[model samples]
Target: MPELVGTDEDDYLTLNYNGFVPLLTKAMQEQQTEIENQQKEIDELKAQLEMIMKMMQSDMSDKTDNKKAENNQKPVKLSMATVK
Candidate 1:
C-alpha cells in the first residue's frame, strides 16, 4: 500500500508535495462539482413540487365552482334509469 506523506506543512517540501497538491486540489474540485449538481437537482424537484401544488389548487377550485353551479340550479325528479 502507498503511504501518506507530505500531508502537513512540516513535510511540505518533500518530493511527495508535488503529487499531493494536485491530488488534493482535484478532490476539492470534484467535491465542489458534486455539490453544484446536487443543488441543481434540489431546485428542479422544488419546481416540480410547486407545479403539482398549483395543479391541485386549480382542481380544487374547479370542483368548488362546479358544486356552486349545481347548488344554484333547480332540482328535478329523475327516474332510476337516468341516475347512471
Candidate 2:
C-alpha cells in the first residue's frame, strides 16, 4: 500500500508511491512502441534483400542462356595424320 510520506505545509503538496505508476506506465508503452517500429523496419529491409536476390538470379539466368547460344554457333575441327 502506498502511504503519503510527507507534505509541504506552504503549498499543501503530498507525495507517495502511487504517483509513480502513471510515469512507469507511459515509459513502458513508449518502449513497446519503439520495439514494434524497429521490427517493422527490419522486416522491410528483409523484403528488399529478397527482391534484389531474385533480380540477380534472373539476370544470371539470362546471361547463361546467351552464353549457351553463342557456344552452339562455334564449330569443332579435328585433324588426324597417318605416316608410313
Candidate 3:
C-alpha cells in the first residue's frame, strides 16, 4: 500500500513503511538482549542476598546461645513478707 510520491531530485531516495521493517527488527532484538542481560544480573543479586541472609541467621543464633548460657549462670533471689 506504500506508494512512491516524490517528484524532485532530492526525493529520489525515500524509505517507505516496508523499508523500516529491518530497522525495527534490529531495535527490538537489541532491546530483548538488554532485557535478558538485566534478568541475569537480577538473578545473581538474589543469590547474593540469600547468602547474606544465611550468614546473618547463623550469627544471630550464636548470640542467642551465648545469652542463654549467661542467664543460666546467675542465681535468682526471692523476697517473703509475714502477715498476722
- Top of the candidates by lDDT: 2
Q: Roughly what TM-score does model 1 have, to 2 decimal places?
A: 0.66
Evaluate all candidate structures by whole-model CA lDDT and list the values in order.
Answer: 0.84, 0.87, 0.84
lDDT value, candidate 3, whole model: 0.84
TM-scores for the candidates: 0.66, 0.71, 0.70
47 Cα displacement, candidate 1 (Å):
0.8
Number of the candidate with higher TM-score, 1 or 3:
3
Q: Which has the better TM-score: candidate 2, or candidate 3?
A: 2
For residues 1-84, what per-residue lDDT tens digits would candidate 2 score against the true structure?
246556687876578878789878999999999999999999999999999999999999999999999999889665665433
lDDT, candidate 1, 1-84, per-residue tens: 145443456655335556677788989999999999999999999999999999999999999999999988968779999988
Q: Could you give candidate 3's per-residue lDDT for residues 11-59 as a string of tens digits?
A: 6655476767887899999999999999999999999999999999999
Task: Locate the minimum summed-lDDT window of 10 residues in model 1.
Answer: 1-10
The TM-score of predicted model 3 comes to 0.70
Q: Per-residue error at 75 for model 2, in Å? A: 1.6
| Highest-scoring model, TM-score | 2
Give residue 14's error in model 2 in angstroms.
11
For every candidate in turn, the CA RMSD to the true structure comes to: 8.0, 6.0, 5.4
CA shift at 12, candidate 1, in angstroms?
Answer: 16
